[model samples]
Target: MRSPFDLSFRLKIPLWGSLLIVVTTLAISTSMMVQAYNDVRSDLVSSASSLGGTLAQTLFPAMLHDDVWQATEIIRASLHGGRESNVLRPELVFVLDREQKVFISSQPQTLPLLADIRQRGEEYRRLVDWIATDAGLETRSLELAKFHRIYVATPIVDTGAYLGTLVTVHSKEALLARFYSVAWRGLGIGLVVLAILLPINWFWGRRTAVPMVQLTNSIVDMAQGRASHLLPQNYTHRDELGRLFEAYELMVEFLQDRARLEQGMIRAERLAAIGRLSAGIAHEINNPLGGMLVALNNFRRRNGQDERALATVSMIERGLHQIHEIVNAMLVEAKGKARDFAPQDVEDIHQLLAAETRKCQVTLQIDSNIERPVPLRATLVRQILMNLTLNAIQASDRSGEVRCTIHIAGDQLLLHTENGGKTIPPEVVDHLFEPFVGNRESGHGLGLWIVYQIVTQQKGQISAESRGGVTQFTVNLPLGDPA
Candidate 1:
């Protein structure tokens, strides 16, 4: 399952943007609804208070003269007046004397239940008492039967003569209906706005998401070595993604240039190593050639079935064979192909380095315990051994022994070379296998570096250490299937 934290930019940006728009829209709509509700309630209370005050003023003259019929007609007219105006119509109107006695009512049938107002609750009693005390017009909300209503009470007075009280009850159903109407209109507008904004948000999101997705895909392709170039047309925008694409192009170009340079350096180093090896091989061959020339000259002097002549010819043949073997080995190493390592390859290296060791007056020792053919490139193995043996011989003191050992451990082949010589300095040992690093003035320093490259290329490791008046090099090659 994909992690929630791994959400792509395409989804994350659009999701959050939509959510923000929705939340803001909802908040605005809700606020409008609340304000509309309060406005409607306020209008209802104001209309009730205005209608009650008007009735109190209209009924004052009739109440002072005790004209119950006139006061009733005035109350009925005021109640019916609301029907023609955009004000909450009163459901009931009651005229009560200062003694809290009902004298006139718009609905005569409710006159008997006016006395039940005192038994209803403290809120109604307080409202009635407040009006009787001439505390100005007052409004209160109460549930009557199944409908909630607002009551507005006003005092009826004639020249400070406390005539009676005028009470008007307005049903809250109309107020609630108006509130709902405004709320639904607001909701409709919000929905329309949301519908229009959603598409725009989606398009905007796609504009950002598509480019980022393309850039991501391109990066993935580059990482997998499937894409070598990016098109400028795809990232033409003046944005961060465009900058990233340009950066990626520059990086790829740099990498390609660096790769080419490294390849050239490696080739140059290999040629340099080959040149050094050729010089050593030429020296080895020159010595044998000198000996062979002497033998040939002696054979010619003792010709015609002489035993010394036969031995001299045999000696010349052996020298020619040795030269041929060394040349063949050099040719093989130059080819640089993976091949099984035979015991003869090891012997060939010893013979190739014989002249160099002899010239240095170093005693070279070969200790071989390899019974099975090693699964490795013969050329690389020979090069590694040759370089180590040469280095050992060069490092050893006069008449000091240089030992080369080959053995198998587990499924790996180990080649080790040690020479009895002055311990190598710590500074030189630190970068011993690096290119152009060597102790000898005549050395170009590419020999051990080439050895290191070959060993690593064959999935092997090479290490060197110097201690106790001896410098040693060890190479471990895995005997596994070729990669």
Candidate 2:
């Protein structure tokens, strides 16, 4: 069972619109039917009264001449003649004598009742009672035993003496028929008008619904951080929907910006972690890196060209030893084991990088352009340069040259290294400065990470570029007091 007040559209708009149309039309139709019925009934009553008046007028002279019986015959003839020629087909009419006896009538059976009732004084008394009654007019409608009739009565007066009454009865069927026919015609026209308007209502309903659907979908997409297009100008009607569309667009832009900011923060956290890990290894590796550099410098200064050629026989062995030591220290540091930091000769960093690249056999030309000493933990710097040079060497083909240019500019020391490597892949270039972030087979990727840590802690800068067939890493550090 449906509730009386469900109030849903399926039950309301179409149903109710149709119902209202029907009900209003029916109400108007009913009113018209009633008015038509009344007008037709009134017309019948007026015709009856006019006929009665005319008959009374015609009978008045006969009554005045003491020819009441002759007046009675004339009444009968007129009643039969009027009834036979009438368009409305009146039911009956009768003329009563001064004593209230029905002397003549269109229907003969009605006369006996009129005369018998008067002889017993019932008809005469009723007639006198009606004439003296408060009702000044004697016109009424009656429904009697399957017949509906209008009654019009008038008194026949001659020389101020009441002679009799003239009464006529008209059937109500014709008037009722006219009322129903008018009602039917009115109903048909109302339906035609409703039919013309329904389609227009449906079209407007759809137009409103479609834009709301689009706006809802767009809002859902924006909520999920998915890209969504704006509503069409016309669709975003200059009303509440338009304001909602504009607000949604602004929300999307704000969320996109916020998402970018959050992503950048996460990346910064990761890079900072990498730097901390690199700083850990730089501590342990600095001492061994310093020892190795001192050894290399001592050997280079004492050994002549021929002796160096002899040592070159064991070059691969020497290079492997130096790389093995630095790598062990790097691995330990990357694991976050606590270690040390100390002042050391900067040449150690340069020498360690050269030693590691022997595996790649790239010609490394290192030229130091310095005015004062650069203060940094030598082992850490060595690990930094070794990782950078090794990556560059791997990028270069065999026999490719790697150049290291060390110089001072203003109050800073710089290490600029370039290798004959192909241009960096754009996909990886964006993450190049990130830790664990390089294209190398033996790459733990802590190389640039350590470099970044040392440079950051010392308040310096570092950058890499792989363009024009050259992969270059540049390191900048503040020059310290040389005592």
Candidate 3:
């Protein structure tokens, strides 16, 4: 069984609203109907008593003269006088003597028996005795055997002597009919009001419920990783729902940004570990490379006369030279050589990245506009250029151009590298120089970090930007006197 509390918010609002309306309407209607019934009853009793008193007064002379026929005539005329009056009609009339004997009556056979009255116990007996006393005008109402009636009795006084009691009996049927009519009208009115309010309640509930439902679904989508780039912008109202949409949008953006930062942090950590490993490997390789170079040099010198041997030696030497350059580039801090940066040095760095450029099927362009060599750390400069060029080559589309421009601007050497590819996203650009912040899957995220560190150490600045499908990195290094 589904719990009652499991209802949707939309349904719950209308359900509870309707329930409240119905309950309140019923309470008010019941109260009003009961009050109307009481008012009618009171008025009926008052009218009966008034009529009974009038009859008693009219029959006083007849009673004083001991004319029973004249008293009976007065009672009969009064009972039949108002055929169209709104007053309660009498069903029975009784003229009781002081001894509780029925002297005259409209329906003599229907007169209540003392045995029957006493059978109802003390309350009924007291009521009957009080009316028989004929002290003054008194009234009593009773319902017995489906017959409801109000009895009014007034004492007939003749020369300060009690002649008899002039009693009138009024039926409650007409009063009951009026009571039912008013009750039904109240019920109908309450029903009409509830009918009117139910739709309005449903409509209002729907308005609130639709947005809530959408928000719930959106939250679920977010949890399941199916959320869109931004939250839906359909809500235009300046209510709480609109504010909630705004808050959700902000939350999504924040979470996405946080995820990117975490990924970058993880990549940076991985690269740091790789860099440590590479440095150790490079240090170990250096000793072996030195011994191989020496052995090859000796072979080349001894095999100078043999053309085939010399050719082979040259190839071996070239391979060793390339390997030595790579290991030295990897161990830049180990070399720690600072010297003037000449055009040839830039050419050498370009040569170092040539294999990578070809592997990526990208064309590399080099431009130098410096008048003379600039004083800089040769090893660090070579490392920076090699890393930047390799990154540009990898970032470029197949057969796209990677442009490298080096020039002297006032007291600074400006180096700019541009690659043709998709524009870098703003989030990546913001942390471009941070370790392990590359957008590429295969990137170690260390090249730019190393470049940034080297440039900052040399009192230079580096900045990256991407626009119109091209990404560029610019480095500004302070020029020093050539040594």
Candidate 3 clash pair list: none
Can you rank all candidates by lDDT, best first?
A: 1, 3, 2
**Per-residue accuracy of model 2 over 221-307 as CA lDDT, tens digit each:** 867768566745746467886777777778878888888678656655676775567556665565666676666666666655576
Name the best candidate (by lDDT).
1
TM-score of each: 0.56, 0.49, 0.64
The residue ranges of model 1 lying beyond 4 angstroms of the native Cα positions read: 1-6, 81-87, 111-116, 120-147, 158-161, 213-234, 259-271, 290-294, 297-302, 305-483
Tell me the RMSD of model 2 versus the true structure.
12.8
Candidate 1 residue-wise lDDT at 285: 77
RMSD of 3: 7.8
RMSD of each: 17.4, 12.8, 7.8
How does model 3 fare in lDDT? 0.75
Order by TM-score, highest first: 3, 1, 2
Cα RMSD, model 1: 17.4
Each prediction's total of clashing residue pairs, residues at least 3 apart in sequence or on different chains, is 0, 2, 0
Q: After superposing candidate 3 on the true structure, give the runs of residues whose Cα lies further than 4 Å from its correct spot.
A: 81-87, 108-137, 140-146, 155-164, 216-249, 303-315, 325-483
Candidate 1 weakest ten by summed lDDT:
325-334
Q: Candidate 1: deviation at residue 332, Å? A: 16
**Residue range 1-483, candidate 3, lDDT tens digits:** 877678877788778877888889889999999899889888877787777778877778886676778877887777686665454777767676666566676664655422244344654455567665546544444444244666666777656677777767666777778888898899899989988988888888777787787788888988997654443566778888889888888888887888868865665566456567767897898889899989988877773368887888789889989877766554436254557778788778777888888899999998888555778766777777888888889989999999999888888888899999999998778667665677888866667878876776677877788999999999999976666
